[model samples]
Target: MKFPVKNELLKRLFAAQGEPVSGQDIADEFGLSRTAIWKYIKELEEEGYEIGSMRKKGYYLIKAPDLVNAANISTYLETERYGRHIHYFSTCPTTQTIAHEEAQGGAADGTLIISEEQTAGKGRLARPWTSNAGRGIWMSLIIRPRLAPQQAPQLTLVAAVAIVRAIEDVAEIQPVIKWPNDILLNGKKVTGILTELQADPDRVKAIILGIGLNANQESEDFPDELQSIATSLKIEKGEHIDRAKLVAKILHYLEHYTALYIEKGFAPIKLLWESYATITGKRITARMVNETVEGTALGISSEGMLELKLDDGTVRGIYSADIEIKN
Candidate 1:
């Protein structure tokens, strides 16, 4: 997503990436006066780019900020394909909803749908996902994997691993994956992954992975019910994070690990998931829609199902459930 600038001057500025572009050069390139070019340079500075303007040597981008808009993200993003096309929204119903529509309309793979806030964000089982304005990462990534529909569930775990790795890379905090979806920090959920697929009975058309990560929220940002159950990277790290950089890192690792998953089987990802597993070898409750079962978690199966050792001296594979780790 390109910014709505009068001209493509911003893209050229970033393309330069520190080498000074003289006002005369910009004026000639954009067919504007030197004064008009200077006005545009000032606008870039006001938009959080620490550009240096000299008397005659013109402007040089000294430092770029970590704003979570399309312009800012494109400035710092280093991924090749994952974030090639980003659709940004200030406020939306949900990135997932729009992503589904886009995917149905034949949007490209690795197209990212991101928003500042989600008014009606959804979680597994129709739970409300809290997404306050400018506080968290409410984004959906579209992927077209050449796999069967059954392999679609593996993408959720793939996203979990990517998110955790990205959090560690950027926030310097190690997050734990709770079974299939939630990424936990200090026993509270800091991120959630919701994977929705557009597929036939045998093949997959596209996978929409909604990643909700709390990057810079304060304790007061969450509702009363979520205050105790949710945490943000800022709250845990005691400093505000660079949301754009974090998102860039996430997209980088996501593209890498997703490609790895497509090539290799789930063996490698399963190993990484176990290293961050908090429920393996613990007592837990699986709250399914029909029945709730209590068991000892014996780790996950080869195919990514939760393996539960029930009290009946039998092991059961859980497909989908709300897991609760009990003492």
Candidate 2:
């Protein structure tokens, strides 16, 4: 269900900052009847929004529940398009799957498919990704960039830079990117980005970028195997992090960096990505499907491949591989 009218009403109510808004004023602004406005307010109250009304005053937002619904996220969004058309779900198998279908059905650019929980979330190499209920930013975004098919992989690096910038904005922590699509804090995995492409033979169509971020989960929220390797923003920040604000910040940066890549080139994005990379100048081993290569990590290539300097001093550009830091 699309909430164009309710979303605008939410933004207007949030702008009042708990002040009362007259029902007549809202009805006039939206060109809706007073009865229609009352119905919308009732729907919002059913969605966990505690709205109060006065005899003379129209309505006031008393409290908003911490949920990633359309109304809640739209109130904090500052982007022009990235989150404008949101498809929010309470629980889904995966946002990536849904975004792919939406993109195939001609979904608009910057269409976002976000969910509160993912029952069958996937990581790189089809690994099972754990997405705790209401504890992470599990979402996929659909983007249509005018680039060739071969140049699509660089968007993953572009998204990495955006995620790091967003984390920095909300928390006093240093987050680093690990190779193709992992974000780490205190040497533990906190975020993962998976970029999938849909294109023709020559031109490109849409790119579905799946982002899984552990936002407000505690340490004990993970399974035994993941207890040592996984972390969340709440565990690191020592306080509950606001997921809605963080989501908006990520969309804001994602929109900006993607536009920068499309306008200028990968050179600018590569520099920003390297600043937050963890493998530069470190001895690491990259494990691919066919073979493994041990080398000192050079920076990314022009096309966003990991440049690895082997023992014989031969620089190898690894397109896709699992990187292990040796040092």
TM-score against native, each model:
0.89, 0.97
Please, what's the RMSD in Å of model 2?
A: 1.2
Backbone-clash count (model 2): 0
* Alpha-carbon lDDT, every model: 0.86, 0.92
Q: Write the per-residue lDDT of candidate 2 for residues 1-327, one digit (tens) a residue.
A: 358778878777888989988888878887999999899999999989999988788788899878888788888888888988999999999999999999999998989999999999998888999999999999999999999999999999999999999999987688999999999988999999999999999988999999999999988899999989999988988988888888888999999999999999999999999999999999999999999999999989999999999999899999999999988
User: Model 1, 146-244: lDDT tens per residue?
Assistant: 999999898889889988998998889888999889999999999999998899998999999999999999999988888999999999999888897
Judge candidate 1 against the unseen true structure and give its global Cα lDDT, from 0 to 1: 0.86
Q: What's model 2's lDDT at 28?
A: 89
RMSD of each: 3.2, 1.2
